[model samples]
Target: MIVGLLRSLSAKVPSAVPRIALTMKPQVIFVLGGPGAGKGTQCTKIVEHYGYTHLSAGDLLRYERKRPDSEFGQLIDSYIKEGRIVPVEITINLLRKAMEKTMTENENKFRFLIDGFPRNLDNFEGWTRDMDGKADVKFVLFFDCSNEVCIDRCLERGKSSGRTDDNRESLNKRLIETFLQCTRPIIEQYERQGKVRTIDASHSVDEVFNNVKKILDKEG
Candidate 1:
């Protein structure tokens, strides 16, 4: 199904660029955490204050899932609703296209906050293979919030978020191992390389953002 979808997509759009294939060298910061771990909030703050284009992985998948002309719409929707990772090829392709599109539009816009990505080893490995040397990853900004808090926040937001997967039942299935199990290795790998800046995200938004600001200020 994925291959067929990719082929169908390629019939209309340009073929995906292979690894180390592009010339764009944007600055990238990966923002990762469980749902409602204050990642989205901090991303917005970063965009406003630091001028980084916030390219949320979840948002990109959601947008593609909802796009009427998208060949991968149903597949993406089903994967997301099941709390599963979308195919690595599709994700890397979208990320590259977004990077290229934005950079082509504004020559000076190169900084990007890629939020909620590399959810597992496959994601990280695929990114390394398919990002086409488009970016120099600055760091991974990890929001360290407890699972309970993250679930609670998701439930509260579901009241108004109008999202199917934000409710308690979905959050229970989706977020139980999102931080500790799914994304732990990626965080640890970056940690060993001194590329993980973890923030205590159980605090109020302002406090969390302040810590994020300090990290951003000190780091490149």
Candidate 2:
């Protein structure tokens, strides 16, 4: 399904839009965290203050799933409903297209806050191989929070989020299967390279963003 989706989308993409080449490396900072870790909130603040384009992998997939006449709509919906990560290729292709479109529309340098991506080793490896020289990961911002807190936050959010995975059942699968089994390894991988900055997400939104701003300030 993923391969077919990629081919179909590639065929539809206009060849006129230039692809990112080896010499043009965009600035990318990965935002990693479990569900309800406030990644979205912090990313909004970063975008407002740092002039970075915010790209949430989940949001990209969700948008594609809802597109009219989308070939991968059903497939994307199924994976999302099961709390499974979408195939890395599909996500990366969407991201690359988005980045290209954004860059073409604006004159500024491309600095992106890529939220909720490279969720596992497979995703990490796929991104490294596919984007090898087209983009560089400056750092990973990890929002650290206890599972219990995350669960509560997700459940509370589910009351109004309207997101399929915001409920308890899906949140459980996402927290354990995706975050613990998959995402944790990716965070550790970046940590080993000293490219991860852990932020305490149990605090108020303002407090959390304060820490995030400090890190981004230092990065700048």
Candidate 3:
């Protein structure tokens, strides 16, 4: 059923990664928020203060989409422009390689802040199954913000962000269908696990990070 649902949403997943498990148990904190919810801004602060490697799922996807020879470039471009989630296989593969690269580059420095990932329950399921539960998730850091604020911030960012999906139509559909309809359940599931640290993100940069600082200080 999960595979069927995923196929309905995107391309058929390649079966190459039936069970590619992460060998290391890195300290990872999932940084989740809707677009323009300030996840990147706060992730920078967290990295500066905590010496953690910040791996953003959106960033990786964008990088791959622009690569001169990336196999997933066209697929990623289509999905981004249409406000559809990329197949979890491509996303998880990117994240897995990034995480492993960080681990290798820094040896014992394993603290990681994975941003803008597991956007829906399908993504969460894909991560658990593919990663084999090897990564130790410290907690999920969720940013709570209103739709108006998020849209406003995204539109402002779109002025120069150069992202394909930053336009009004794309942002509106993504926020409604993906963020509210899908991502909320991921937050609720993590909340039930007592692993969610919700931060009010409708404030000024410094104001929001001040709250994030408190949560990380306690939860990190």
Candidate 4:
């Protein structure tokens, strides 16, 4: 069912885009976690130590929403304000463009820490078709943190973060609808493939990254 959806969506990509996607083979590490699960924090550490490009799906969406003439800006803003996941097609297009741009500019091997992506089954399917066999997901990094802890962290960060979705109202929806309902199944799928590396994100920043560093060092 999901594969069929991917196949259907693949035809929607522009003719020239697939050629670019096919040529830019990158080592992709998907970073998955709930809101305030420290995905961004850990991704920064991974980038500094491993030289991987950190592409946060949330950041990409936020930037696109603020872009001067983006066609998806209003639509993205509505979904984000409601704490609903954006459509997979839009998200994957932004991700693929970012990956292609980075890969084209750099002569070295491309390694990407794609944070908070493949948020649901549709996202996973879209990514598979969109990349056109160029990149393989090396593994998924799942940051395990309790909802109570996550909410507290988000609230603290919200005081200064200025992100609309960081408040209590949207956090509730994101925690339940986005994380539990959508993301958990995606993690399970990767777990079945033996491609998931779980990290305890309930700890201090240093402690969490210590665990992260170990995994990256061993994996890379």
Indicate whether candidate 1 or candidate 4 has the larger TM-score. Answer: 4
In candidate 3, which residue pairs clash? Answer: none
Cα lDDT tens digits, model 1, 19-65, are 33335688899999888898999899899998999898888999999
The order by descending lDDT is: 2, 4, 3, 1
lDDT of 1 at 137: 92
Badly placed stretches (over 4 Å) of model 1 are 1-14, 17-24
Candidate 1, position 199, lDDT: 93
- What is the C-alpha lDDT profile of model 4 across 1-220, one tens digit per residue? 4344445545654442434543547889999999999999998988888899999999999999899997667777888999999888778788878887888888464899999999998888878877747787999999999999999999999999999999999999999988999999999999999999999999999999999989988996
Task: Assess each prediction's global lDDT (C-alpha) against the native.
Answer: 0.83, 0.87, 0.84, 0.87
TM-score of each: 0.90, 0.91, 0.90, 0.91
Poorly placed runs, candidate 3 (over 4 Å): 1-24
Clash list (residue pairs), candidate 2:
none
Task: Give the best candidate by lDDT.
Answer: 2
Q: What's the residue-level lDDT of 184 in candidate 3?
A: 89
lDDT of candidate 3 over 147-201, digit per residue (tens)? 9999999999999988878899999988998899998899899999998999999
Candidate 2: stretches off by over 4 Å: 1-18, 21-24
Query: If both were scored by lDDT, which would come out higher, candidate 1 or candidate 4?
Result: 4
Model 4 C-alpha RMSD to native: 4.3
How far residue 102's Cα lies from its native spot in candidate 1, in Å, is 1.0
- Measured with C-alpha atoms, the lDDT of residue 202 in candidate 3 is 94
